[model samples]
Target chain A: MSGTVGLVLVSHSPDLAAGLRELLRQVAGDAVAVTVAGGDDDGGLGTSYELIRDAIAEAGSGAGVIVLPDLGSSVLTAKALLEDHPNPQVRLVDAPFVEGAVAAAVIAATGADLDTVADAAEEAWHARKL
Target chain B: MPESSELTVVLPAHLHARPAGQIVVTAARFTSTVEIVYGAKVANARGVLALLALGATAGETVTVRATGDDAPAAAEAVATALRTTS
Candidate 1:
């Protein structure tokens, strides 16, 4: 939690979130705080508001938190949490899940500010897989 | 300003997400404007998306160009990052 910008990955699948965490650890190292908020309370394929909220709080180290969601409900859950909590340091990025996570993780690990990390996450939207 | 260097990517996995992310991080450290030229494609070194778009594979040669006060260091650092296997 001492890093510049922490990350919360929201997904419908726990394995996807865990795999992405491992991938981010390999790319960005251990400097940034990466928390996973995937699946529902029952460990099913759904987004959990409590999980997202808890992850944002856990990952935040005073600098900021960037949340990346995989799909529809995940995004809605994260946005809903933001609306209810209204934390200025939190950002919900509309970006590709894996790519955005990697990009943001690398930038955040460098001790970048919240806006910079958010920008890096958004930039992943233009990533060309072809 | 305007320093350039050619580097061969030696990573067995090529310029995948991890290495491309590393390159972006390394290039972002300098104040220089860095770019990676692979064949006909030119990618912004500071952007992970652009770097990944280059599709630079292992053993492929790419040119690193930079223009700023830290151009030299930027070019060298980017080159080193590309040349690194891990």
Candidate 2:
């Protein structure tokens, strides 16, 4: 549990992030902590800075934390938070939302390191859904 | 020694997300290096996205190969995981 890398999924739509989190839990099991920060403060379909910051703080353990943002603004929000308060254990990976989270979760379930988890998520960009 | 198995995917959706995750979990159980070979693509069995990207479908054949001290067991275990992926 301590060795498992945690994941924070940031999305504009709350359902999208929550759904992906559920799927990740099912695929990777609950051994790896999978958290989500979705929607804006007003309950609209947009990214929220506070939500992302809180989720990252919640998901970050001593082992490591990998954050996957679903949209342009989501990425911006996450990056802003990271730039404001740098955390060495946290990294934002550019990967396809669903595939990337799935990849990261599965590897994190195996207690892989942060670098390995990030690589797995980034590798998901090449996941062909044909 | 290295071991291998040519398995016909029985899963309804081929190696979709769930089934691929199953393979990843099973392959992670052994110390061997597990690979699934389909056409010219060879993916590490522990990689869900890579396994899904193999584009292998149901009724198609994929070779499961494992190399390490526990290669034979790893191969057999992954083969079984592939076959029972419904």
Candidate 3:
């Protein structure tokens, strides 16, 4: 595992997360680690703790992990999980999901560190045009 | 000193995600601070979302500017990416 920062996207819909993952892969190739925690245990519209937990574990590629949750309770579920198993390297970012992931992935693929990845994601929301 | 280059977007469908990604990849290869300017919008060239949002379509000229040690090469590479998809 390289020292590049990885990303975990938490969305309520499985397909949404998958599509976004595909998009990121197209851009960053295999340079950045991007995993998704979408849908519930039943594969319906919801967030799953197991999915989120496993995703972070899988995506925590030595350097750091940044988790971006979709909306509403998805955020809550991710927050609750993080509160219990907090690692300073694992960051839960509040930014626009698609834009943030794109920015984060691009920067991470450049071999940027944790803070640079987080800053890129956070800055994405402001850089987005209408 | 800052270096700058300009080119027309030849990619079909304008500055979408894929072409934007190509531009980002090129811009990331240098130590320079790179930017893409289209109309009133100036986007950080290393950022995919910002470049896509610049909204430059085919035939529309965009400028690639950079400031750093490798500014000239950085600006040229980004402009080439805009002119032809990789």
DockQ of every candidate structure: 0.57, 0.65, 0.62
Comparing 1 and 2 by lDDT, which wins? Answer: 2
Question: Which segments of model 2 are wrong by more than 4 Å?
Answer: B1-13
Can you tell me the DockQ of model 1? 0.57
lDDT values, one for every candidate: 0.85, 0.86, 0.85
Which scores higher on DockQ, 1 or 2? 2
Q: Give the range where candidate 2 chain A is weakest over 10 consecutive residues by summed lDDT.
A: A121-130
Quote the TM-score that chain A achieves in each candidate: 0.95, 0.96, 0.96
Q: What does candidate 3's lDDT look like per residue over A2-48, in tens digits?
A: 66899999999999999999999987778788999989999999999
List per-model TM-scores for chain B: 0.84, 0.86, 0.83
Native contacts kept, each candidate: 0.48, 0.69, 0.55
Task: Give the C-alpha miss distance for residue A17 in model 1, angstroms.
Answer: 1.0
Candidate 3: residue A68 Cα off by (Å)? 0.7
Candidate 2 displacement at residue B20 in angstroms: 0.5
Backbone clashes under 3 angstroms, per model: 0, 0, 0
Name the 10 consecutive residues with the lowest summed lDDT in model 3 chain B: B4-13
- Model 2, A72-102: lDDT tens digits are 8999989999999897899999999988899
DockQ, 0 to 1 scale, candidate 2: 0.65
Candidate that would win on DockQ = 2
Candidates sorted by TM-score, descending order?
3, 1, 2
